[model samples]
Target chain A: MTVLINSETRVVVQGITGREGSFHTKTMLNYGTKIVAGVTPGKGGSIVEGVPVYDSVKEALRRHPEIDTSIVFVPARYASEAVYEAIEAGLNLVVIITEGIPVHESMKFTRYAKLNNTVIVGPNCPGVISPGESKVGIMPGQVFSKGRVGIVSRSGTLTYEIAYAMTKAGIGQSTSIGIGGDPVLGTTFIDALEMFREDDGTDAVVLIGEIGGDMEERAARYIIEERYEKPVVAYIAGRTAPPGKRMGHAGAIISMGVGDAASKIKMLREAGVDVAELPSQIPGLLKKVLKK
Target chain B: MKLYEYEARNLFREQGIPVPEFRVVSTAEEALKAAEEIGGRLVVKAQVLVAGRGKAGGVKLAENPEEAYRYAKQMLGSEIKGELVKKVLISKAVDIDRELYLSIIVDRSIGAPVILSSPEGGVDIEELARSKPEKILKIFVDPVVGIREYHAREAARFLDLDEQTLKKAQQIVIDLYKVFEKYSCELAEINPLALTPEGSLVAIDAKIILDDNALYKYPEFSGEYVRDLSYYEAEAKKMNFSYVELDGNIGILCNGAGLTMATMDSVYILGGKPANFLDIGGGARADLVERAVSLLLKHPRTEVLFINILGGITRCDEVARGIVEAIKKTGVAKKMVVRLKGTNEEEGRRILEENGIYVLEEMDEAARKAVQLGGAI
Candidate 1:
């Protein structure tokens, strides 16, 4: 019932022989993600952590036709090419874990993915995890447990932090996705909200956002426009951030007097979302909404 | 990174977009000589990266070379929007019949490049956008398709230009897009794109913000346009950490950008002020963490350091070891509240506790402790 991924979802690891790729492949595999094949170009015929590696995504697809998704841990320079390879191979989903890809490349590839009917999750994201069922990202497995609350965020460790807090409060999640902290992303809060709204297992959603773009405001508008029925709890970081200063993440900035936390919080509240001032308040807000 | 107006103007001129003839000079004497060469009423502009330069009195129109010298003397070494004006751009002033706005920006929401054009153009463009968004014409250009002839024509027509002027304006739009694409600019702006009395279009001002990630392709600009980094910030950049200085006391350090920002927000909310935002980035080893700790401890505003690490790819023990190593190396006895969780939490905690530093598992608890110890109560 989880959105994007589930236990049966077949996965291919792009850049599988690389340090991050190899490490996360084992981690995802340990979390019971159905990682069927790996792609590392020159490292074809090599096996990484018991998974067969292929030179190309096409070759890997030929060997494991059951592969439906890809998690890319390629370096930033080659990350876009890897994404295009996955998209052209007709993989349904491609999650990019690589950070620092050029915005132009991401814009082009994301558009290409859209036209090709493929879902591109992140260029600088922590991938997706369906709690106990599957973990495709680099998030710690212990912090998340299977439940009905769908979580989507724009951060990595922050997502883990909030998820851990929720887990500590005995509130498990249906799926937690880090949509990435890049300025241009393939999947946004609105896109994840749409998927969450359709998922029968997700009774509510927790949106984790930060300063930077107008994505949060846009998501709030989408919710109101669609008259979305699900009770959504939200948390936005960077309330104290100054204007024009990039707060670590490339996309996390209050620039040109727009995309501040105050405006985002206001918009989300106007959409009837229970926006928590602190990450720890999320579980309590979710409990209150789900109870209704 | 934001390019100086003169630098942006150079790029625009190189791309065949007509800009007022200009000379970039550092000295007032150089500016006078340049103004004499131009032989016309000129605008002397301070070359600062900050916005609203004109409003900050960083720009002045001079009637003659003597006035240009006076203006340049007044501007150079002067502060505009908190940025020191080290360079001045002396340009031949154009006779403007009308002013318009044009820019190509990577619109993140649509995931594509967008051209925004308006008949209204100036320092007040942002105000115009906020008050009357409809006044601006937005044309979303697909990155694959790029800026076509029609896209430019559409923009020119939006500004209600006459047939001949439309053709020239359209060409400018197309050329500007080329500059934007060629340079991998986040924003390529020609504010106050002036229509001269004789109907020729001239870019009065140029603003191009190149994407920092794509700077490798343009190595010339990589070192030049880093927009004034503070001492600590520059140090952090050298160490490959994301750092932003803030006006606070508690030095906040974490593994991820979002987590660092969240930690800062939490500290602020809990009556504590964060000194800076520092993300050691994922998979940071002990040496990097050690350097980061030393850097934070060196900050004068950092009374206490709050280190929150929710390790996924980043190992906890590595961070803990770095903290211990930093303390030993620097011998700066600053109070530190360390929160080490996720991978190898027990080992990390043990490493810190062995060095007489107690660790908190909960982020909120650690933040509270740092705030309390920092005397934010």
Candidate 2:
């Protein structure tokens, strides 16, 4: 069984009338996700892909009360309000695919979600996809095949790249989660790693990290101390960022300190986790662990 | 998105938080006039968005109006953390009996705003975290309910303040929470909130980091351009491209995270530190690469240029045309080494060769030549 999502996970599409919402809704539906209802404030009662549309999250929830997860496609400006509404509606899991959302909005929403027991995947990410069960965000549907490797990352495109590389190397994924590219996000690497550890189907884990935050180091400590049965493979992006420049992702700031790639790789190596210097080397590293 | 002490205090004052009376001034005359009108000792702080400015000789305590002039004169044109000091905050100094630290920041894992307080103020919190972590009390506030009165009381009690001081501290915390929420700040901190000789609390220092991504709501965000760059350097920045003027001869360009990094490392391995790491990522257009080359050529250290294009989704010929265009525009007779591979490698190589720019097929050979030529720079 997939860890975060499955066939039983009824979903609602927030901002379903917008261009991105409409496009990804089609993708999710084609991938066999149950698209229960859609929410767009002004465009209620309209139908997209034969799915029901409602004005607010409450209205959509009223129509499809069984919906446990929400896939949001709202623009950056309105992402917080949309997320807040879904959380207040008691949706257990929310996947936000909108890029460029304000950090303060995510911080506030994340804080609110924590007080409540809602789990948010991203505000500037590709969202999570449990192959063969439910695909949430913008991951290419073709490259993924269901297997035992649990994948999590701070990058949008790199997740797709790693997943593709894994598939090409004859490795399939159990679940893939994009933690997003924001400096302050709802969940950390450890949080996702814990979930992977608990999931019985996940045989190993592939952690895709970037140059920012102490998250990779924190995850390394967890791996060292916990001594998980499954092997963990790590690949960090942004090794070429200038000494003091901030990259595209807000979390990719490597100013005076915090978020250097070499230091993160060193920590992972010391922790006994197999670390790949390049993205292409991940599959080979994972296979070596399997042989051992 | 960090604000200076004066700016944070201004925000706090607007929110009805108790702070020393202050005026932000640019000129020495303005600073002296403010100090004279206040009729007391003043603190002159350099206006720069950096921490530890007090230790950097940016903060000065002026005992008289004439001293204020001297301090402001010294600080106004100075540089702190790469930011020029264009302004100074002249504030009426408070009589300090004791000092405490307070802050509220977003805790990502918990998804809550944690209000942190400690009696040990006017020091770097990181140092405190490393040495005496137990002295700091953290209260995780529910964002839905916000910073409650009970939470404020708990923090005050933990700070070990007297009943009257606790009340004042409680009110300040409540006001600070409001300021944090309203300003869209990621972090709002007040260090050395001094208990005055008169037994009232005054925020002696404040720091507010406004969330940079949230600046879309603030129209002034885009218009504020600080540094001056040359024509090509400006154009590269305008297109959201990363360009660094470096002390080397080779101009290296590649795409993707792993590819670009490997290219740079290869250049270094071949006994040449790359002039710049340019990733003309997916869908690389000729114009973007042209601008990239133009920016690279502007560097005084560049005696030779190396253009490495690996076309995954980006066409190799596009990268070649950009190098050719840059050669035509700059008119500089700099030595160049070209490496093109992937999608349309043959066609891309033909474009470079037709334009009289010799193409080096191997990565190592390109690096060796570029480094050997650049060493003369």
Best by DockQ: 1
Off by over 4 Å in 1: none
Question: How far off is residue B374 in model 1, in Å?
Answer: 1.7
Candidate 2 per-residue lDDT, tens place, A36-77, comes to 999999999999988889999898888777989998888888
Which digits, one per residue and each the tens of the lDDT, describe model 1 over residues B125-158?
Answer: 6798899898899999999888899899899899
Per residue, candidate 2 scores C-alpha lDDT tens digits across B157-229 of 7767788889999999999999889877778888878987777988999988777667656554334432334
The recovered share of true contacts, given per candidate in order, is: 0.81, 0.26
Highest TM-score against the true fold, candidate: 1
Considering just chain B, what TM-score does every model have? 0.98, 0.82
Error of 1 at A87 (Å): 0.7
Q: Between which residue pairs do clashes occur in model 2?
A: A111-B111, A212-A259, B251-B306
Q: Which stretches of candidate 2 lie over 4 Å from their true place?
A: A5-12, A22-39, A44-69, A85-92, A111-118, A130-134, A141-146, A198-200, A224-226, A238-245, A254-267, B218-377
Interface RMSD of each: 0.8, 4.4
